[model samples]
Target: MTQLTQNNGQIKNNYCVIDLETTGLDNLTDAIIEIAVIKFDLDGISETYQSFVNPGREIPPFISDLTGIFDKDVLVAPEFNSIIPKLKEFIGDSILIGHNVGFDVGFLREFGFNFEGTIFDTLDLSYVIHPTQLDYSLTGLSLF
Candidate 1:
């Protein structure tokens, strides 16, 4: 990994990191099971929001195993649409940053998020910073 000083890094002071745990990969077919957003800057995290969404369908065993979020966990939770207002309010106009932002944004778009903010993908940044690494997944990078 390349060393990056605070003054030399490409960190965004006006950004909100977004992530979504969905029922599956297909944005057209699957539903968002969970949502998390963090509003932060150089100082630290200013705000954070997370919620489990009722997908109105079964949570596949594979996804449950991977995310550790099962159907029972979200049974009494609010639906995706119900939390859009709060989610948008928290995100505001900040740039979006995520590991695979496109995938998260694609899923958001399906739920009518229609976000127009700029996006930064940490996965792509990982490839540029550590091109020789065998894995680029979030967990893989952490362990490496």
Candidate 2:
């Protein structure tokens, strides 16, 4: 990893930006159907990992419509447990950056992965930076 000094003089390189598509909105019950992680360093993207996760249950129709990740799409994919090790290694000592990151962190904790690092939430930051914006969602910010 290419180390770079932050404004505070902390040496760091990896910033793992993650996103997950789940079976539902309830973190306690829903399972992750898809996960994507992109590791960025000073030079740019150092690694990328993505996979369909077999949630072990049928994906609700509405979710399928939203994500295009149907039950059939993940039926042959690896389970969450199978990807934990690789996911951990990919995120090693990296700060996490995401939109609505608490939702993702909740699901990850439910899956037994303990994340102990700095988190940068774009959603919260957007609200502060663009207080008058009608929407602070990822799509909304992207459109702006």
Model 2 alpha-carbon drift over 4 Å, by segment: 1-9
Angstrom error of the Cα, residue 86, model 2: value is: 0.6
Best by TM-score: 2
Candidate 1 C-alpha error for residue 25, in Å? 0.7
Candidate 2's C-alpha lDDT? 0.89
lDDT for position 64 in model 1? 99
Question: Global lDDT of each model?
Answer: 0.87, 0.89
lDDT of 2 by residue, 1-144 (tens): 545445577987779999999999898889999999999987899899999999999999999999999888999999988899989889988888899999999898898777888778889989899989997888888888
Minimum summed lDDT over a 10-residue window in model 1 is located at: 1-10
- Clash number by candidate, in order: 0, 0
Query: What TM-score does each of the candidates earn?
Result: 0.88, 0.91
